[model samples]
Target: MASGSASLMWFRKGLRIHDNPALQYAAEGTKFLYPVFVIDPHYMEPEKNAFSLGSARAGLNRINFLLESLADLDSSLKKLGSRLLVLKGEPSEVLIRCLKEWEVEKLCFEYDTEPYYQALDFKVKNYASTAGIEVFSPVSHTLFNPTDIIQKNGGRPPLSYQSFVKLAGQPSSPLSHTLSSLPLVGDVGSCVISEVPTIKELGYVDIGQDESSPFRGGESEALKRLNEIINDKEWVATFEKPKGNPSAFLKPATTVLSPYLKFGCLSCRFFYQCLQDVYKNVKRHTSPPVSLLGQLLWRDFFYTVAFGTPNFDQMRGNRICKQIPWNDDDELLTAWRDARTGYPWIDAIMVQLRKWGWMHHLARHSVACFLTRGDLFVHWEKGRDVFERLLIDSDWAINNGNWLWLSCSSFFYQYNRIYSPISFGKKYDPNGDYIRHFLPILKDMPREYIYEPWTAPLSIQTKAKCIIGRDYPKPVVLHDSASKECRRKMAEAYALNKDLNGMVSEEDIRNLRRKLKEDPEQEAKNKRIR
Candidate 1:
């Protein structure tokens, strides 16, 4: 422990003050510490192959949410007689500059394992090592470190959720650390701490609040929500993940704590301990793979797999994923993206996702299915890319993993069991209240025709004041036929087990594409088997 030394605390995803291992360690044995956040250009600039550079890497909804989170974190730091130093540049360059100018003896940050972050952290670590600056990095982003858990499982991450839960077992007690006092550094020369950037500054328009989603980002709000949910012992004890209604727009049955978790506004370990304490008192406590506890387990499972698996974001070369020739239909994909797919059930969920920057788990399942195998048959990567931009809670590991699961490209493989773009939502929201609220064009639509307005006669549509192909675009494709063709294609691909690295050859994909245009079961059978 070096006394009277200066330390730099680089804030990344773990933005909150509580249960933060890196912050706790950095503040220790030091008289003063400076908290810093670097705004990386990588996130603010488009990649070389990006479709467009105007939006950069993130959408308006996520940008607004992130800016709010940063502001909240700065406020929390202020109450403790400190402030956040915001810097805009590449992280390695900024960190190197700070290390020399601030005359800092140590650098501390939470461990992150995403490929991009991993590479950046490596550069920073190497620089610190060469310069003889101590770096204190503790893994706190997840309940358990993915490396440790995977190593315990024979150097490979568990393939199934059940396997992962069995290996992870239970949440241990939360770390007993507190930031009762934080000492300020002597001087931060020439590092004029910038304020968190606004959406306009980041080149994005601010997306206004969604009446359906009442979430506000910050450590305070996260803790408040955590307390409320835990205190409701009845909800905690009786909580079953599957039974929660995705279409319950009035109020989501689930706690809706994911965005907080994603931004590290709340500590996963602390939340787990609190949940366990409440769960102990209840007579009927649900278990993992489908409980509130199960959600955390699912998160960890994805993280572990992502950490161990290379190219985990895509289907090619992913050992765990089953390769299939997925379609690249931009027109249909665009329709899905803009909420004009004419399937009220699918369109409503997309509206909710874009408006709120979050949606229920089953709703995610519904939309992801529609994009991949259910209707559009677009590649899962396309959906993952869209989600990465739109979701405030978008995580590299979780987002890709879930898309693969829903698409039957990996993790899950019940390709025959595709989600119905219509009845799945109707099962939960039979009266179509969810559709009416999100897609106001269908607000006056009769309950029967709400999910499938195209099926209704012109008179009924006119009476509702909404017309198919005029007000809302007609269905992108007939759900029944398209999904069936998709399933057949998936089956043929799976049977072939061919590894397609790029676009499936135009000629080969043309045959599958033709299946969408006409019934070609006999054609598909003869071509595939031969």
Candidate 2:
């Protein structure tokens, strides 16, 4: 807080200048300001295999989005007489060295709840403390700090959405930090810093001029999109999640600003304020668990749970996750991933996900259900990994949380309510236009047989030039039979869990499954008793 002290503002997820509390703190009373972003190689490394899991490999689309956001941040900083200094290497090491070499008196950054960042921050804080450098971190990425929400809920994260909403009162209003200028970075001894790296330099194939996401990434673009959505007062007032059309691709039913939010390119508080402004003008608006505001709350809800829950991403040690015996069939998973599932509806969603790096929430539900408790009986973690790599809006907390919900692994227990891959898409796009757009092989297929192309007669297949089991694929698993089997397995798991008072372990689940295989009659009798 001393005047004329040097400050280094560390930029992580909080990429925007507007309503950034940490940035404002770093700028205040500083004689020299160095706005810095670290590019740790952990996230930039190339994957050994395309489908490799448990790695930090980011898809090119997301990487490109990140680069664009950093560039935009730098541009915004430059307009205020400062620039973002992009540093490469391990974050703690680079930051500590910079602190000493530049003689920085203070270090400030946005508070992050993710365990990875938490550990990294600990190291940096320790080094800064030893060197007598001041440290300040303010929560800005999420609406409310997870720790505060947990405290309000009596030392535990509220599991249910309704419970979470009650604990999370109105979010604090966004702060205004208008600035005429910022002090320029001056006189570093030997520390190296550069502008944001090009995609090619970061080891990605240079994105071609034509190969671009329709959703451009930057704070400028985020604000423009936010304004466009907010200006439609009527739409904002009545927007509901269930009413959104999954097949409306030409113009999506929902705001597509999730990527901006995920990357902190747009401040969550700023967006919340904009939504509140719209709601004040309307007489009565849609409420939570469905409304547009509800969607944002769902995001915060996941963050709170993830922060409080141990091993939140994985099933083995995740306390909330049910130990369902998910199959380890790579072939089934590959079929689902490669868009060769033979179910046109499910495959088309996957195609959209791969190509566009975005999908409607309902579309996500359909595929996630198919891969897990609905049909293939694959693990939700597998699907979670795929989404984490592909989705432009993939957040560690939300991605895992949604996969768990859709799979009936946790949060949601209604495993019997399966999303029919065929009927789900038909309800929204009866003509199967969404399928046709993504899967051109199904374009000429008749409308009646579009959702289930294998049912088409050989003559019809020939006429359409898209033969099932030949050009396209036959249905990987019969939906009715597979879903019935999956439900039975889920019931057995749930019953066993109930008998154990929800204290079932991974080994216990495996034992039950093994017992069921060995003596079906005995297991059935035991299940009936339980």
Candidate 3:
């Protein structure tokens, strides 16, 4: 911590310069400051049989967003007389090497609760300790340290939003860390520091730029969007999640700031402060679980729960997840994933997700419900994987948490209340213009037949030039019958869970699923006879 001591700041999710405590600490009173970002092969390397610009875990859209954000960060740093040093390798090994090579006396980075990052930080800290280098990691990705929330809740994460909000209280104000200038990375004896690599340089075939996306990834863009949205104080004051229109694609009902927050381009605390300012000026405003502020709190709630629970991403061995006999139907899952569900409402959302890597929250709700308890009865894990790869705003904790909720695997228990694929979208987009925009095959279809094209007569279909079962595939499953069956299955699972007093083990759940799969009809018959 001495003046003139060299320091290195490792950039992970906290890609922006503003309100970054670690970056400020690294730059303060240092003779030479090194800002570094490591491209780990774990993320960059392709998965088996996967076709994507990066790892199958991340698609081209997410990769491009990341690269753009990094490039923007580098630009911001250059304004302060420094540049981001992009290195490629395992992070711990890379950082340790940099520490020794650069003769770094102090190391600083944003603290992360993710299991992978935690393990990496442990390895790097061990090396730093032995080398007598000081290490500092400040929490900034989320509004508050998840550890603090857990501790305040008596060493457990609050399961419900109401409970979480009470425990979370008020988020601290954003830190003001203005940097007039930064110390240059001077005299690194043998360390080779490279600039940010292009999409092709990362072993991805250059899928042309993400020109179609409405979002541009960067700190600059993030701030710009925040200011523009927040300037409308009246809109911010009355914002409610349920009232938002999922079908309003051109002008989305909600602020599309999720991707920015996910990548840490926009500081959550900074956003929280902005919302608080808007609320202060208004006579009365919406509150948590629906309000704009509530959205951020919901994000924190998921983070805390994911941190507290083991296997939060998977149903098996997940303490909070309800064990259900979810079917493993590859064909059904594929049809759902590829936007071939035959329901314009469901298919259009999937298509939008593929094209733009973003969608309205309610649209997400419709597709997620359809894949799980609503119609297909596919496992939530399958849906989680698709979201992980496809969404630009995908975060590990939130994605899994939502999948569990939507699938009725955990958190939410209202399995009976299904999102009707036909009626749900009709409420928001009665004209089906949203459907026409994404699924152009049905562009000429009449409004009467838009929601249910199969209901139309042959002559009417011919007039529209879109023949159901020919131009467009028929519905994969009868929604009414499939939903009733799904609900029956869910009720049976819940009854079994209740009978077992919610103490079912992973092995027990596995056995139950196997038994159901092997002789489901016999089991039902036996129950009827009894």
What are the lDDT scores of the predictions, listed in order?
A: 0.82, 0.87, 0.87
RMSD, each candidate, Å? Answer: 4.3, 4.1, 3.6
Could you give candidate 1's per-residue lDDT for residues 1-530 as a string of tens digits? 34448899999888899998888888888777989999876676434554422256875565566778899999888888788889988888898999888777889998998998899999999999998889988888888789888998999998888788778865555569678778785577887668887767765443445432356777888899998999899989889999999999677888878888898999999988888889889888888777898888889889999999988998766777766667767877888888878789999999888778788999999999988887777899989988898787899999999998999877888988888988999998889999998999889989988888988999999999998888987877777767777787887776645645433554555565565446556334422121
Candidate 2 clashes between residue pairs 3 or more apart in a chain or in different chains? none
Worst 10 residues of 2 by lDDT: 521-530
Ranking by TM-score: 2, 3, 1
lDDT per residue as tens, model 3, 1-530: 34447999999898898888899999888889999999876676655665334585687678778889999999999999999998888889889999888889889999988888889999999999998889999888888789999999888888998898888877877777588889987666676677887777776676554433567898999999999999999899899998999999999998999999998999999999999989999899998789999999999999999999888988777879888878888978998998988899999999898878899999999999999999988999999998898888999999999999999988899999999999999988899999999999999999998989988999999999998888997888778877877887789788878888777776766776765557566434322121
Q: What are the clashing pairs of model 3?
A: none
Q: Compared with the true structure, what per-residue lDDT tens digits does model 2 show for residues 1-530?
A: 24446899999898898888888888888789989998877776555566632126677778778889999999999999989899889999999888887788889999998888989999999998888888999988888889999998898899999999898998877887576788877676677878888777766665564444567888999999999999999999999999999999999999999999998999999999899899999998998889888888999999999999999999887888888878788988999998999899999999888777899999999999999999888899999989999888999999999998998988999999999999999999999999999899899999999999989999999999998888999888878877877888899988887898778877897797775467555324322121
Select the stronger candidate by TM-score from 1 and 2. 2
Q: Tell me the lDDT of model 3 at 399.
A: 93
Off by over 4 Å in 3: 1-4, 45-48, 51-53, 205-212, 514-530
Residue 68 deviation, candidate 2, in Å?
0.7
